[model samples]
Target chain A: MATPVYSGAARTPQRGRPRDASRDDALRQAALEVMAEVGYRALTMDAVAARARAGKATIYRRWESKLDLVIDTCTQLAQQNLTEPDTGSLAGDLREFLSAFAAFLSGPIGKAAQALVGELPHEPELASAFRETFLTAQRGVLRRILERAEERGELRQDAPRGMAVEIAGAALIYRLMLTGDPLDLPFVDRVVDQVLVPLVAKGQ
Target chain B: MATPVYSGAARTPQRGRPRDASRDDALRQAALEVMAEVGYRALTMDAVAARARAGKATIYRRWESKLDLVIDTCTQLAQQNLTEPDTGSLAGDLREFLSAFAAFLSGPIGKAAQALVGELPHEPELASAFRETFLTAQRGVLRRILERAEERGELRQDAPRGMAVEIAGAALIYRLMLTGDPLDLPFVDRVVDQVLVPLVAKGQ
Candidate 1:
């Protein structure tokens, strides 16, 4: 039930001592490592500071609380991993973007993220950051692919857009988190071909 | 990553006394309550025993570890809630089953379960129990409905059986855990109607 402090917006930059980008990067990486090791509930600002080799006051100056630090760090990490891959076709574009996403989830940030994702509902700010910085970004990539497909006459005008955006990612996550299934290239291909292509692609 | 100790097996009954059914029930309920309060990684046997008003030794004698106790408690709770409802059509059967599941997730056991689900990958035994006791059981119900539909010629013979079974639940979980979206009756209806019905229903 802890209120999560989000990283973006509403912060007037302090006048004295401009922020150090490298030190901030170090702290974000440290926060991820600490969260991966200890999980969300046990994560403390002191632990992140110690891990990052920065003074506690330094961390506090940037982030109002531990949740803020975590949200900021994770948001940065997700943004860093996400790139919209355009392959000219919706199927190819989806596979590229989602495959990139699946790879990220299999990496350090994603591993750390799993520990915190379960707790998103308790903290409104955290959930918002997760959606805005991560989930929405991923969905936005999918949405763009669909729109382009429509322009090229590759997608039907009435393909259930909401359901189209959701099913592939939903099924992939279920396989990853719930079933512990292998998320390889071939698996991604199947999701696109079988589920996604069937759902939306024109003249398939 | 700690290997989770599962509850159903590998317990050699301690020589002194057979476990009383009522005492066992009390312990499981107490374990659930404690987990609902503290979450999975922080849950301890001492807390469960204290909550149950039983000696720590009694709990230890039966279950090997806290993970074992939690798995047992959650599995029992899931089983208690899982009853195959036959509503003649796949859509009705899915709606009824998933609705019941959504209700359980909104309750005490489900609330506590959200905290533990994230840790499943770290613990092999815990993941197995989850897949076996809860997830597989739920899937099994869906499979039966699908099979029955096929038998009645209500389903296409070439419908991707695996994807058909997976999409609805996956979308629901995506909404519940990832999107933090409301899993209300209407949302469930869309998942069933928009996604699921299109996936398998004949003549779509």
Candidate 2:
């Protein structure tokens, strides 16, 4: 399994002429587009290279394989403008978080993710990369939000943060993948109001 | 896409000596074994026929395609014996349910399910069959249990039964598929006590 190189931990910044930032952006975008169009199974390094108009060596220079590239692309795509919404209460934060999450899942990333889950078992390296790059990062965001709620006495201390996040996130994915249901705003609100808030809310 | 054949909802039971029940059982078992050895993607009608020591036509006679065979096999295998544990409370029923669910997800069914999820997006027929056979049936069991709890004045009137079931089931699957974590008894208990019970329990 290819371990994630870009942990949030401080790394000594590479001391050299910076690689072409625009080229990197282009390659990542190309990768996401290909993944969205054809699933992870059919996505190939050569196609990404062709789409990005870059040499295979250029992609290989950064990522070890297609899995690595796909993982990195998904991570980049996922990190677009995550703002923690504060509605002055846990209910407010949950609503915003769930709503944003539903939007993303309905968008390109979600489609790609639904495609990736099945492939994970067969491709351990890709699975590890996905866990490290996307799952861990997303969990971190949810954890921070939950921590804020906890500090405000909105969430019960006894509630398990990890389990809560999994339930909230997985509910959305299950609906999308199994039921072919749209994760609309009303659905998100209902999930937050009726499911998550009550489970984690501090007082009875 | 193979359309499910239903000879009307009220088809009279065929009045004949029950056709080779043991043969049907053997074929289903054979399908599961092949799925475990090779994944769902690699599993084929020819392979299943060879493994079961039956002709391809014989297997196809019962099931229209690999999807039908596999879906039927999964449905048979996932026949969970969920006896409602009456520890005199909702928490007890939830705990028992979670424990049993976690055990199944950790077993062969979990591996098959992971493979199925991967296949679901690309194969619409298989996805639809999976929903009707396994996912829907499982949800029904959980729903009935929750409804029983609600009737006993143990649950909120507007508690999201479907959402709660999805979350509970997905938490187990997410851990197994993404994290490679063991779904031990304590984990099940935590999910029940912390997530499920609270979400459904009566009163704020």
Candidate 3:
């Protein structure tokens, strides 16, 4: 059997004074930095420890393995600007979501997210953690936004909000991953105006 | 420098007893099979040669490196279906394109494609070749279909065909790569009928 390369539950929780929470933040940030700089394949626990100015024990105290640390860092990075906007209109809310989502993709988190996706098939646990922590959270935000829109009678009666969320977010990610293009304001504008607004508009 | 793994350019141009092209085909198929079984990181050229019952010289003669062989094989596997229907309308054409595209993603190429994307960052040359061969070809297909739609007055005159194509294909790829979903027919139908067609239709 292929050995388990990573697992979140493998870490033994510390019983003493809670370790420096600040160090946790620094380590997570360091993980993202190293991943972006060297790619996921080259990232190592030692590198993350050195970059964060923390001992290897500190990292191990929190994450069971490098994959665990990477997943946590990705989760934290994705959550940085995940607040949902309530502009009272589906267009406004979706525009904000897409804009923030685009910024995240083009920002540090984007690099980490791409690296994580690249690592998924090789590391099944990392893949599962990524879905639960990052993708599922982001999808939740989009679902809530769409649910509000649907309640307001903004979407077609037969429209699937979950699929809508998938389409919107997937469109942006596809560009980032496959095209290797910068996510610009104009592209965001086009996605919102052309795709989101019309799909959610009451009448066809 | 890393030792080259493939041998596509080394063979002499001989007329008598042309090298068995069938052996080359067998090796490529075997490579993909091993990749699906053990993944890209653990795959070996010797294993491929053994699987094909061909000498290592035969394998190296056709590909200069493992990356080269893998990329060529992926291109061959991916090139199976590129047909786009006229259908007399943009929606119909897009629906057809997406359906066929989904089929490829769920088929043999899908697993190899995922493996390749996972391996790209570790191998930039392979990534570049993948983009040039597979991604560029697929994008061209979508572009041609969209361009024809615009010419037929089905798409908005001001609509960005490039962005539209990106969104359509990206949405599908994103779900496949991140969500691990099946990219089912109903999802494709909803995206085509709800998200794509209305977005590209003329007039707000």
Candidate 4:
């Protein structure tokens, strides 16, 4: 399995000029488009470069292999615009977090994610990248929300906090990958009001 | 793209003698082993037949194609030994249902199911089979549990019944596929006591 190198996290000394953010975004977007069209199996550097209107050498310069490129794209997809919201109340915080999550599930990132699910078991590097980036970030968001609720004295002290993250992550991902249901606000509200509220709220 | 042929559900008239139950089980088990070893993309009927110590002709007499065989294997894996339990109380029912589900996730079927997750997006017929067979059956089990709770007056009438099932299914599958955590009785108890119990209890 290949070790994925995030742009800034590489141990090697930084080269001359810093990589362009816009160029990286365009490359990742191109990779996502090609992945959504042909899936992870058929994706290639040439195809991604052609789609991005860049030379193939440009892709190799950043990512060591196709696996490296896909992992980076997945990491970017999960981390882009992901920030913990400070919505005062537990319900408010949950609503903000889940709404953003639902948006991710309803867009191109979600489609690309669907194609990656089957590959996880076969690809150790990809699986670890997913856990380190997407899964960890998701848990971190929910954990902060619960922490704020705890500080506000709005959550039960004995609440199973880890399970709370598991439920939220599972419900959304399951719907996206397995059920093929619409990941809309109504569904997000169902997760928030129906489950998260009852499970975490200090008093019912 | 081939439609899966479940026994006794085939549109074509009964052909000759009824298929042997033991024979079918062997083939499905063989398919699962090969899938777990090589994944869905590389799985072939020849490998399955060779593993089962059966001729290719015997395999074809049942499944029309490789997709057909894999789908049937998935359906069988999910449906095997799955039955609704009447544990009477809501929490008891949930514990039993989740324990059985946890058991499935901890076994060989779980490994095979993991590989199938990625293929679902690319294969329409397989996706529908999953929804109709596995997903529907999962919902049906939870629905019956909730209905029984309603009869016993243990559940809130306005409770979000569907989200309960989604949470149960999602949490377990997410843990198995993404987190690579242990799906034990302790985990099952956490789901029951923490989320499902609070989410569904009438007066919680």
Best by lDDT: 4
Docking class of 1: medium
lDDT (10s digit) by residue, model 2, range B40-83: 77899999899889999888767777877787677655553234
Q: Is candidate 3 or candidate 4 better by DockQ?
A: 4
Higher-scoring candidate on TM-score, 1 or 2: 1
Q: Backbone clashes in each candidate structure, one number apiece? A: 0, 2, 9, 1
lDDT of 2 at A184: 94
Tens-digit lDDT string for candidate 2 (A1-204): 112223431111233556676787798888877876677878988999999999998887767678767776676556553445666677777777778778877876666777777678767877877777777777776776688788887877676677768777777776767677778998888777777776677665
Candidate 2 collision pairs? A118-B118, A204-B204
Candidate 2 residue runs with Cα over 4 Å from true position: A1-17, A84-88, B1-18, B80-89
**Model 4 chain B: worst 10 consecutive residues (lDDT sum):** B1-10
lDDT of 3 at A111: 68
Worst 10 residues of 1 chain A by lDDT: A1-10
Full-model lDDT for every candidate: 0.75, 0.71, 0.72, 0.78
Candidate 2: residue B196 Cα off by (Å): 1.8
TM-scores of the models, in the order given: 0.86, 0.85, 0.82, 0.89
Candidate 3 local lDDT, A54-75, one digit each (tens): 8998788788788778877766
Provide the lDDT at A25 for model 1.
Answer: 88
Residue A197, model 1: lDDT of 81
Comparing 1 and 3 on lDDT, the stronger one: 1
DockQ of each: 0.53, 0.56, 0.45, 0.70
